[model samples]
Target: MSSIAEQDLADRRARAIQQLLHTPLLHRDTPSFDTIATSEQWLKEWFLRTCGWILIVDYRRGMARLRKVTGWIDSTHPQRSLRTGKSTFTIRKYVTFCLTAAALGEHGRSRISLQDIAVAVSDLSVRAKVSPFTDLDHKDRQALVDVLMLLSALRVVTELDRTGRDYSVDPTGNVLYEIDERRLGQLLVAPLPPARCSTWQQMAADPHPQPSSGAPLDAHRLRQHLMRRLLDQPLCYLSDLPDDDAAAVSDHTEHITQWLSEAGLALEIRADAWMVVNRRAGTARSLRDGSNVSNCALLVLPQLTAQPSGWISATHLATLVDELLDEYPWWARSLRNDRNRADAVATVLRSFDLIRPQSDGWRIMPAAWRWAARVDPACLPPSSSPIPTQPAQDDLFSVEPTHQ
Candidate 1:
């Protein structure tokens, strides 16, 4: 290929990678960043090579699916609450999703109405010795509708007449939908059926269940997996690697660094974890958001930095949140659920490796110092100062949290 052609192909691949990383899952009916990426063999191969994610392209169904096998705490996306306007997904919503998926599989229909779905879900849930859908309170009913909307967003179901969000307000409200059974079947990317599994722990055990020595490590595939992790996570720890992968990484360190540098990223090697550092990368959230959760996380950062032991109890964290709410009543007065606020803050912190949940409590990770001086400088007291210039008593980066 000519230089110009090569550049064009590189640009297209870059855009496609960005799309998959951000959205992860794609459906036939939804608007995708690049429709061509799904159909093109090269793009499909790229995803497989890089992430170990299986991109199933069912052209007949107009569906392109990425079956995720690894990475992150929440493999299945937890959507925002439509009725309550929260980022966190509640238990009610989770139960509703289970009911919905079960109902759809049992229906065996081309098209179905919302009321019909509700009835089907209720029957299925009751049969499974789970909560009956009919017994749902107004909030639970709304949650059911919310999960339906999420399904619609993924194009598993198409809204024909009234919107899914509309049904959240009025359960009795009539809405029409056309179910895409093929796409719905692809929604759950599991190796085994739920009936065979004893616990949720079995889900992530080994996505590819085969004899350990069946196949040798495909060098190209391994490289792609590393690249995918570099792009997907803030930090990839060496300790997290399987034996074969660790050997591959050790053998090809220089080559891997070259690949990352070519892709506009620099590798930061530490004792435990490796970071794909990009100084110019943009983040979704700013520190200035008036939301109580964001403010709480900001307030907690300084105290977290000042901790001598590098760990704080959940009780202490909640107390710190309470102090913040007391000081900034105007900021958090509208926030009703104190527990949810702390959970949300922790979620945000964990994403950036600022704090990790431990057996005792949440441990302050070394990467958290990046925000020590950056967040609410005027608001924090002098005693809870930023990380000291000199080397700390403990080597922060020397240790990695074994807890998930």
Candidate 2:
């Protein structure tokens, strides 16, 4: 094959993997079809080897799904709003989302008008004894529309005429949509049916049986799995692995780097850490640090690193966050007075494996020290000596975002 041809093939493969990591689900209407169609098979095998499961590609429906399975615990991240800053959602919104889904399922028709959906949603909410939107203000109705827009984005309901915003403005009738039944089912990608588990705690527990210690470990397979994870995830900690696997990964750092290079990815290896620096194949990254929660994480990272024992309790961390909020009230106004600040921060930390909840409190992970190093004064440009006081409108989770 020509050199250019090989590079093109490699670029396509990298894009496929990147999309799978970034998007919770991929549908045909989106531009990701190119990657999903050309590289589906390769992605399926790669995910199976790395994550212990395969991708679900519904060719007839034009969908590619990836079920995020972590240690058999089935708590996926909350469905965040694409437009909302830090994607905040109230419990009412959550309940409304489920009720709307049930309403759609019971509607039985492929097409429904927005007015009809509103009536259905109102009826469902009343049946559940939740607050009715019969007397909703502009903001409250917008929240309901946000949930519907999220569903539209996921291809659960195809807007036939009017947009979600229009529905929010006046949900009396007019907006039409066609329901994608398969896509609705795709939204919940749990490994087991809800009937099998009763409580959230039971669902959170590892469902798989532990492997026997006497079973033979395939050295090559172990190395392959480690390499795939190093490339796929933001970071892989030794503390999360078995002793033998951890030792094997640490010993084969050089081989892993070489393998990454062959696949056109740059690697950064440390004593107790490894990460992908860049992709030479020019594929876009999936993990981005541009949310309000992420900004909070960055602001508090230096304080966490300065601790003598390199550990801090969740209570202390929350106190630190309170201090930061007081110092910069306009920074993340969404979280400043919000009661869920701790939960939001914990969610961000858990996503990056930056902290662990122990008997005493949360333990800072080694990989998070990189954030501290990044904030060093020496790393700043001469013109930008001090952190700017005037927050940019483009700042992630900014109080007044320039873009809606």
Candidate 3:
């Protein structure tokens, strides 16, 4: 192929991979479905080879799914609401989601009424001895509606009457839905059937288990595990990984970098860590956004980097936040009196692996140096220096090596 043609193919494949990473479940209505469908073969081979993830593209069903599994349980990414603001699913909503799925799976019709599904869900909950759903309780009714909305988003069900919201408000109100049984069946992607698995560990077990002794023949497994960590996490610390996996990373750094580059991700290698930086947008989370939490995190970056020992006490961070609130009067007004603002900022920072929770407080990670504000010596006062001003742009994953 010509250079131009090869570049175009690479870009198309990269876009498809990014879309799958952001939203693992893709349906006919998804904007990037055409690119994903066209490059299905490449995507399948790439995901399987790189991360051992399964990529299923059903052209007949007009949907695609990437079954991704990580070495550890990741609580950072959660099934969020489809509405504006995108609130994370709560425990109640999660329970309702499973019950609703079971109800739909057991129903014997292609078309079912919203009220019927609710009744079925309540029945299943009672039989399972879980919290029974009651229309009398507004919270229960809302949770059911949320689950339906989520299903609708996944294209498992189509709300024919568009009155699903009404059921949440009024117990008597109902809506009709057309169920897609095939899509419903594809929802669960576990290594073992959930029925046979008694514990979460069993459910998440890898079917192709790697040898514990790290034999040369099983080197591919180590590579897959390492790639999965680099792609799925914000940062892959050598200390956080198993000894075998960490050794594999150090031994085959160039090979891993080439694999990531094919998917339009840059592999950032550090003495103690590695991180995959997306070349394109929409593939990863943004920490420089205009949200209150992001802004707070940015404001506190300087304080974290200024610590001589890289460790700061929780009480000290809270006091810093109070002083910041007073210094920047125009900052997030809602957090002005919120005592938990410090904790919220810490959570945001921790999500990016910029800081880690220590026994005493939080310790700033090496990766945080990329976003830390630098003080200007020329403008420093004789007695004390003001809070350092942040750079004009906080480019994600663009940083200099902290160590030689």
Could you estimate the TM-score for every candidate? 0.72, 0.66, 0.84
Candidate 3, residue 80: lDDT: 75
List model 2 lDDT by residue over 15-64, tens digit each.
66666666758877756667677777877776665555558888788888
Off by over 4 Å in 2: 28-32, 57-62, 72-77, 90-92, 118-143, 162-174, 192-208, 212-233, 242-277, 280-300, 312-350, 356-362, 375-404
In model 2, what are the clashing residue pairs, if there are any?
none
Q: How much lDDT does each candidate structure score?
A: 0.64, 0.65, 0.77
Kindly list the per-residue Cα lDDT of model 3 for residues 219-264, writing each as its tens digit. Answer: 6777787888777775788888666666766677767888877777
Better of 2 and 3 by TM-score: 3
Q: Whose TM-score is greatest here?
A: 3
Q: Looking at model 3, which ten-residue stretch has the lowest summed lDDT?
A: 375-384
Lowest lDDT block of 10, candidate 1? 385-394
Per-candidate alpha-carbon RMSD to the true structure = 6.1, 8.7, 5.1
- For residues 333-378, could you state the per-residue lDDT of candidate 1 as single tens digits? 5553455666677776776666878986898876666455466544
TM-score of 3: 0.84
